[model samples]
Target: MVIFKPKRRVCKGKEVRFEITELDPFIWLQVNSESHVSYSIDGFIIDSQKKINGIFNKYEYELGTTLDVLFETLTQTFSQEIYACASFASILNTEYRIFIWPKDFPENFNIQDKLIISIKPVIKDKSIDLSSYKLVNMSALESGIKKLRGYSFSNVKSLLSANSNVECFLANNTGNPWPGDLDALIYLKSENKTIALIEFKTHNKNTPISDEYIGKYGKQDWRRFEVLYNLQNQLELAQNHKPKIFYVVWGTKDFDNHKMIKIDIISNNKVESTNYLDRPAFGESSMELFNLLLKLC
Candidate 1:
């Protein structure tokens, strides 16, 4: 009789179970896995510069490897958190291509605001600074505000990046936009060509109340649409861009319940959706996914 047992690989346990792909080709990815890089999870990958740049590392497997094998392999060897070239990655690697996403993903700023950053693949031990990640929900939108504010650039980017497959070396299909020339534009980050259209409504106190608000429930609803149309045209934003028009609605209560209801109807009617941000003190409402948004922002 003969007895034989399998051999275990480095960093992995005794069961040569889950297999990992060889990460030799994507030279850019190697730096992130380096020994020097130190990191922790702040929603997503935050590099040495305190920036969120989406990145992933993939390992290809041979014929013998099974999901069970991969699953078992992943259970061993440790490095719980660190700043790296990708998001939510493990022994997982897709067979085909993946798009390349833009480097900088915004922190606590709304997707509808005038804030943008282009970060590269950087890894460091230190953490980020995010005191300005603000989102004040004036109406019944406290939850929404917190969700929005909680997101730092890294968290926002990581959530999206982690879901997509990483074998093809592809860019983000639903790429994030940067604030456009007018207000803001979250551009689709891919080698494949595409257009972007973004709008930001800076609610400075001085800016007069839009007619849209006053005409309906005395909250300028009509004026906002006009601005939206104008903004869409100026940017040459295609219908697909889903041209968004944000109402920062800053300062003291500029909108009442009746006004909000009217605006809500208008927004629902439009192809591109619209949302509001209000403070809890005024409305006595909880923040919607706003904190979550901020965490990932």
Candidate 2:
């Protein structure tokens, strides 16, 4: 909902209420109440940026000038926190800006004399059963594909590029790529019109191996190496660069390290390191499946 608050009473007559009247696509204003009483805009401010900008007519008010406002939001585990691009406008020589505040803001907060307000996404009541959201035994690639099933291909690509959750992709009727036996497909947005074939693998402690597999790296390394070799071969056979291959592998153990290549399967270091330096062979964690796809770019 949008609210507009004036520092003082602006209506001259005995107007006690006000309603917005739209003049055009870019013009809007408030007028006297239907009962003809002076309206008092003292306690609250308009909560919407779109409505505020339309009513204030930034272009008309500033007459070809603009103001920019910048801010960083508290980080979240599953979403973007920083808004790299934001802009404001001049309102009666005062900077008027809009943004979504951290969800932790006090409920009693009011914009009364403040020049900024956040435009947050309206929360809609969920009608689906909570039990339907239960997790299952699924591979990372499979999970990502499931999350993107109802979203547009473009939206999926954008979310993957931004390293955002695929569950956040906007739903649409556009064609969505299906996951293959190896990996999911990603369509490039450039003029080259390339299709990215990715292979996802993880070697976490929970990974299961066959008892017949006897080696330092065992079956895990063999599976990864086989996929890597096949992808490399595909890279060579690709025509007009129509197809590209990428490997997204994550785990505590390093595949390229000498200890793994040798017959040393046991690790002396019991403490698992949580930090990861930038490397192509390993990802930060097993969670960022979409991020690994973006790294392929």
Candidate 3:
């Protein structure tokens, strides 16, 4: 495995540090230890100033604005030098952007061939220790489920009907056959029962909480809600335990300030009953969400 030493750079007057690692066929790149990017293609260059504006402008009007069309067009547009790009709000609420083009790519290459994007919190603060809580290996869990069922748990219906000893379950369908994975799933170790299901949203502090943003993020939250509801029903039948679900959003200073917004589930997945949490922290021992989860469990 190839590992790059953590390096720091100044972005928009703020210092950002990141690391890169070669994890077998994929290049795992992480920014500030929170925002993660993974891709399988090799020999790509990262140009901060370069933008795929021309491609977007050319296709936005012609092919409609759906990401599916844009990605398909991108796959067909460039051959030798393929560009793969993604921009999202990091867990720290900073704008995390990645744009890379291969020095030479295969003619049959597709951008989504082996790309995985995820976020994880790695805090340097050591004021608290949470050794009791373990992060479950999702891959191993999925493999076990597949082996037992003789097929992948690719849909919500399949999962709702399945029987397993595994308490924490993650939706792993990449094709969106059902809802995608939730942000986090916490289970009771002693009882082997799921306790909490969480969905996270990150955004800049200055960004307004507009209807458009709510519609986009709320849709995702609603999908998670569906999964949680069904999973709870399944658990109630199997183990007589129903897990509580939460939706939380974070801004740039929210983590350090120990604050986050919790969204209450209402009918139609509309954004209402939003409230601030006092001890919000991610991937840390003092994570306030864990406290809430313990209460639910």
Which candidate tops lDDT? 3
**TM-scores across all candidates?**
0.21, 0.21, 0.36
193 in model 1: Cα distance from truth in Å? Answer: 8.7
Per model, state how many residue pairs clash.
76, 12, 0
Ordered from best to worst lDDT, the candidate numbers read: 3, 1, 2
lDDT of 3 by residue, 105-200 (tens): 111234333211111212223111112222223343234334333444334432331111111123323211111333444544345454554555
lDDT comparing candidate 3 with the true structure: 0.31
| Residue pairs with backbone overlap in model 3 | none
lDDT at position 190, candidate 1: 29
Instruction: Report lDDT per candidate.
Output: 0.25, 0.24, 0.31
How many residue pairs of model 2 clash at the backbone?
12
- Cα lDDT tens digits for candidate 1, 1-297: 011111112221112223432211111111232222212111222233322222222222233344345323322311222122121121111111111111221122233442221122222333311112222211212122223233323322212222112201112222222211222222222211112222222232333333233234433545445544543443333223333333333233344531221112123325333344333343232233123222221
Which parts of model 3 have CA positions greater than 4 angstroms off?
1-179, 205-224, 253-259, 263-275, 279-283
Q: For model 3, give the 10-residue run with minimal summed lDDT.
A: 51-60
**Model 2 Cα lDDT, one tens digit per residue, 12-67:** 21232333221110000011112111111100112223111111100001111222
- With candidate 3 superimposed using the best TM-score fit, by how many Å does residue 224's alpha carbon deviate from the native? 4.6
Per-residue error at 276 for model 1, in Å?
A: 4.7
